[model samples]
Target: MWKQLILLAFILANCSATEVKKCSDDKPFPLAVRVLNCEIPPCDVIKGTDMIFEIDFFVMKYVTKLTTLVRATSFGMTIPYELPEDVRDVCTNLMYHAYCPLYATEDVTYLFKFPIGNYPEVSVKVEIYLVDQDKDVATCFVCNIKVKKGPTGNTTVYEIDY
Candidate 1:
């Protein structure tokens, strides 16, 4: 019985969702944010790997189209990263066969995969935004992440700010 209990606890901890902060006070925040294999801030991401994110959100108003915006802030500078044409369209990425034309009162989960590239080893604040067709933000959130070198590279150090 003790072994079973410990296993359950470990499973719960590993599967727990990440707590993220809202990017803007005026915009709606996601109900939950789950970064696969990550449950805490300053998530360690190795280069050449994919960071998978699952965002649970509710639509407060009808939206015919949705777009994703990703930005990384470091050293007091924010740089926007343009996703591929297919990944930029959020509607196509909705899970469970869900498509565009999301209606009010509908709960949806969006799965986003960000491919890590050859980025410098550093800590950055990542901001994600889902914009509706009207150019208004549907939901937004922010989190801190640390990028590290891959296995073949030398050890990289990251400076994190609270």
Candidate 2:
């Protein structure tokens, strides 16, 4: 049991931390964006695993609209993703009611878990945009992540980490 615990500790200590990639936008965003933390992703995840996303942001202005898009792709091609109808219904209502910005001074953290599936190349991208009432972007954040299979089926590749 001690050996198992030590191994787990070593793995956790040596693995690279997840990165907060730059968000590209066509127009200037009104507010500043900062990524507090991005946890490391598993090299490969099996289907049905709960892929969690935890993000915290400070609103610099009064935000009115918010939208998020999560997708998987491989070799520059789009892969489809569909949430269950029940989940979709909750998300639709929850997004508007729970997350719709009400105060400018409030610092909010939004977290969601995605049901993982067979993703090609383990490439996933998450995009989130906060817009104002004029349909203009208040802030946009995006991250593109690619997971590489480790040696021995489950080993860390420090070269391509993050």
Candidate 3:
């Protein structure tokens, strides 16, 4: 019985999602943000690995297209990370058969795979945004992450709530 209780507790703890802050007061917040292998702030991102993020959100109006934007800030300088052309289009990455022409009150899940390159080991503030067809912010969130050097090959799967 004790073992079963401990297992249940561990499962529940692992299932908890990450808590994230909005990028701006005017920007809309996502329903939830989950970063694999990063359950808390200062998520450790190893160089030459892929960092995966899942965003759950809802649209307030019809949207024919969506784009993803990412920026990292450190030491008072902000650098925009340009996503590949294939990954920049958010509509193509929606989960569960959801597609654009997203309508009001529609729940959507977006999956983003970010490749960590050869960047200096440091802590950074990351801002992720999803913009609609009209250039309106659909979902925005900010997370603090630490980039570290490590042996990199395949993507590592972990849970992080932001």
Q: Estimate each model's TM-score.
A: 0.85, 0.49, 0.85
- C-alpha RMSD in Å of predicted model 1 compared with the true structure: 5.7
Give lDDT tens digits, candidate 2, residues 46-160.
3434444444555556766544444444567765456554432222433223566446665554444455654444666655454446565544555555544324556443322
lDDT score of residue 52 within candidate 2: 47
Query: Which model is ahead, 2 or 3, in terms of lDDT?
Result: 3
Error of 3 at 53 (Å): 0.7
Clashes of each: 0, 0, 11
| Alpha-carbon runs more than 4 Å astray in model 1 | 1-11, 153-162
Q: Write the residue-wise lDDT of candidate 3 on 1-162 in tens digits.
A: 999999999887765667777787779899988887778888999876778888899999999999999999999999998889778899998888999999898999998887788889999899999998889999999989899998557956454533
Question: How much is the lDDT of residue 44 in candidate 1?
Answer: 88
lDDT of 3 at 26: 74
Evaluated at residue 119, the lDDT of candidate 1 is 87
Return the candidate ranking by lDDT, descending.
3, 1, 2
Model 2 lDDT, residue 21, Cα: 49
At residue 72, what lDDT does model 3 achieve?
90
How accurate locally, in lDDT, is each candidate?
Answer: 0.85, 0.47, 0.86
Of 2 and 3, the candidate ahead on TM-score is: 3
